[model samples]
Target: MENMPMPKTRKPNAQWDANATKIFNEICVEQVLANNKPQGCLNNKGYANLISQFNERTGRNYTRVQMKNRWDALKADFTTWKTLLLSASGLGIDPKTGTIAASDDWWEEKINVMPLCKKFRFAPLDNDEDVEIMFSGASYTNTNAVAPGAREGSAGNGNGNGNGNCNDKDNGSDDVQEVYPSPAEKQPVKRGAAYKSPKKGKKNFRDM
Candidate 1:
């Protein structure tokens, strides 16, 4: 029997450390909220500028799609936090006394208390559901196989030629060409391999 394919994992970008989160938080607060706007609200130009600034400062590559997804996740977290705060106020407490206030000060205090980096960090995905959440529209394919739209015989070895095969006509060498595996290839585990739990850690994706 064939073994089931193992899930692929990626590491978090170190450049998108605490500093990047701080910058993002400040941008939203100063540029968007200071003018009496909602949290996590940004126009196209605003988002573009934010991405540019983040990449420029951190020297990291972040696509626009990633920034948008990250913003959505942050906004969702903010909304959930507010909802929980509102719900807590009604439990065994006087409404007028305000046991748990959800005010601007409260919001700012929450933001100040924790860095956005920690708040938005993603735990490593261990199941299909987690992968779906992290990569909603992405399709996983075997990197060892040619891509769907790739021209036949066009997958080349980084040598600039479309032909992966070494030919005496192309280069005056009758030696057999050495083929290398694509970096994205995943080696299959043997059947009945023991399952091991992944160590507790965070992973970064375009969304995070």
Candidate 2:
């Protein structure tokens, strides 16, 4: 094949170049406008700061010139991307403060108080009303596994004093149960035939 001369690279068309230039100028103008706007919380130099933070987070080297180009590209979409800058760069400036600071501690506290918080309560029986009866007999048996009474300071072991067998029956009657009244409901015990009153030297019905 005969060697064909390679066509010289054509210069960009004048009309196309002019259109591209217009677009570029429009983009630069938008960037300047966005940069000058009074963003309530974002710093006056937000674009520059955001670029530095972005490079730090991505572990990539982005030169200032690259950041400038990116800023120009993103200027028209500032509102949508503002949150990304705020969260990632800790650039969540407080509007009232006019300067960025660490996010408010109350933000975490508010989260803790909500349903989504880790400290939220969980109750399997949140609204349950029916509770099973624990004790039914006068004297609870060993099978009940009852906790120790406060007076004895020792857990029950079937016997009344940790010595008697729980299986023992008192005449096979339910009367074997010991009636213990709450402190608020207690009354003086009646004097019986075995009672010896110090004042009377004998059982006193009046004391009862």
Candidate 3:
């Protein structure tokens, strides 16, 4: 009988590559946002920056163009994630068959894997108008919480979307609802209403 060749051992899969890439993409996007770094709208330079950071930390080599390509891939992955979330929200997320179905456990798993954190945090359940209604003054809760949609005007006045304002405006000018009530005593009164009853005013109308 011919001698049989020994089977070669396969190299173990590299888990770090996937995890490192995910971390790299997330940090780059966050850093760009935090520093208010400008890379032009629709620019993927942020993705390159992330790869650079990752290489520096891990001592791995990656070309800029390659990083850009990876970034593009990441963007595509993000779109998939968005779709999955949408589908999961509508149909429940089923982990067993990898199908969306109704179950908190599956849904939570899907949410936890989201690269950008919970979508709810970035996009509230309510509309802009609803946010305004929830975060409005007097009814606002967490007095310590930053006001929504309150921005410091060019003149340094807390005109729109400033910290003092109850309306918590996001960095991108999107408004987030407050959903809390102020102290009952400080609540505003209706227009043309008097502190006391109009009993005394009744006599004034008759005299007129």
Question: Which is the winner by TM-score between candidate 2 and candidate 3?
Answer: 3
* Candidate 1 per-residue C-alpha lDDT over 1-208 given as tens digits, one digit per residue, 9 for 90 to 100: 9999999864342333446656655554343322212111344444556677777877777655555555454444444333333333433322332223334344355556644322311211113233322222222222322223322123223212122111212112222232333535423222222222233432212221
- Give the TM-score (vs. native) of candidate 1: 0.34
Better TM-score candidate (1, 2): 1
- Please provide, for model 3 over 88-206, each residue's C-alpha lDDT reduced to its tens digit, 9 standing for 90 to 100: 43353222322333344554665677633233322222222222222122121223233343321212222122222212212221112222323442222212211221133211101
Best of the two (2, 3) by lDDT:
3
What are the models' TM-scores?
A: 0.34, 0.17, 0.34
Ranking according to lDDT, highest score first: 1, 3, 2
Decide which is better by lDDT, 1 or 2: 1
Residue lDDT tens for model 2, 16-94: 1223323433433333233321211112243344445554555444444443433332331232122222332423333
lDDT of each: 0.36, 0.28, 0.35
Q: Tell me which residue pairs clash in candidate 1.
A: none
lDDT comparing candidate 2 with the true structure: 0.28
